[model samples]
Target: MDGHHHTAHSVFPKVSTTGKKGKDQKSAKSAKKPRKAEVNYLPPYPTGENEESQEQERIQLLTEAPTNPNSNLTRDVVIRCLIVYLEESLDHVLKRYDDADEDSVSQDLTVQRMKIYSIKTNTSDCPDDVGIVVEGMKVLAALGNFPRACSMLLGLTYAVNVANPKELRYTFEVFQKFLLELDCSKLSPKVNSLKNKTASLGKWALAK
Candidate 1:
C-alpha cells in the first residue's frame, strides 16, 4: 500500500535526463525495472519467507511471537496484514481446490481448514507478530481488537477444529478470572474467586 506509486515507477523507470546513458538507451532498456528492495512492513505488516513443513508451523511463530512493545506499530501492522491474510487465505484455498473434479464436493473446498501465512518472499527484519489470517477471526485479530478477535476465535474453534493461539492466550480469554483456551485442561484455582468478582462488577454496574 505504502509502495504503490513506487512500484509503478519501477515498472516504468524515468528517462535519465543526465546524458547519452539516457539518449543511447533503447525503449526496452528504458522500460526495464530494477530489482526490488526487501520490505519489512515494520509500521504494521511483514513476511520474510516460507518453508513451513506443517499447517501449524505456518502460524505458530506469528501468534506466539512477542507482541511488539510498540503496540502502535503492532496495531498498524496487525490491521494491515489482517486484510492480507484474509484475502490470501482465500486465494490459497481456491488454488488448492482448483481441480475440476472438486466441483461435485464443494464442502472440501471450504476455507475453514486453511492455515494462514504470508506468501511474501521479499522481506527483512520483520516484527514477529506479523501474519495473514485465521479468517474472520484472523481479520479481527489483525484489526487490533482483541476482544472481538477472541469472540471470533472461540466461535471458529467451536465451529471447526480451529486451533487456539498458544502464545497469545490472554488476548482471547473469556474473563480474567477464568480462560477458556482449549489447550488448558484445568480451570484456574482462583476461578471461583474471579467469577465472584466479575459477578460483583456486573451487579454493581446495574445497581438500582
Candidate 2:
C-alpha cells in the first residue's frame, strides 16, 4: 500500500508540471512582438556660398536698370532754347542790314535773305506765339517788304509786352539793334516812316 501511494503522488506532480508548461506556451503565443523604431528625415539647408551668390544676382539685376524716356528733357526747356537761338539770329541779320554801306547793299541783302531762309526752315514746325511773330518778321524782311516787317515788329512788341514783361525787354533790345544798324536812306518811304513810329512805340512800351 505505501509503494502505491508514493507512485500516485509522483504521478500528480508530473500532471501539474505538464499543465504549467502548456499555460506558459499559450501566454507566449498571445503576446505581441516588439515594433521597429521610427525614423525622421529633414530637407537640406542652403550653404553660405549659395546664399551669397543669390544675393549678388539680385544686386546685379537692380544695377542694370533701364532708362525712362518720359523722365528725360522736358518740352518747355526745348521750346525756350529754340526761341532764344532764333531771336539771336534775327538780331544779327538786322544789325548787318543797318550797318552795311551803299557799296555792300547787294551782299548785305543776299546775306540777310539767306538768314531769313534758315530761320524759316528751322522754325517751320514751331507752334504760334512770339516765335511765329519773329518768323513772320523774317519772311517780310526777306521779301524786301520793310513796311510789313515794321508792322510785324510792332505787333511782336505789343504781344511781348502783354504776354511776358521779361521777354518784352529782350525783344525790344533785339529790335533796337536792327533799327539802329539799318540804312534809313535805302528803306522805302513808307517803311522809314513806319520804322520811326515802331521804334518810338517799342521804347515807350519797354520803359514799363
Tens-digit lDDT track for model 2 on 12-97?
A: 43222233458788986785643322111111112332334545644553343224323223433442343464343334323323
Off by over 4 Å in 1: 1-147, 168-186, 205-208
Query: Which clashing pairs does model 1 show?
Result: 44-77, 85-132
Error of 2 at 78 (Å): 22
Tens-digit lDDT track for model 1 on 1-208? 1133123333443444444444566654675443323221122112332223222442442454355436544654653454353232223321221223434323432344433322212343332232224532233224223323333444444334444454333333322114332323344444444456768999999995
> Among all windows of ten consecutive residues in candidate 2, which has the lowest summed lDDT?
36-45
lDDT of 2: 0.35
Clashes of each: 2, 2
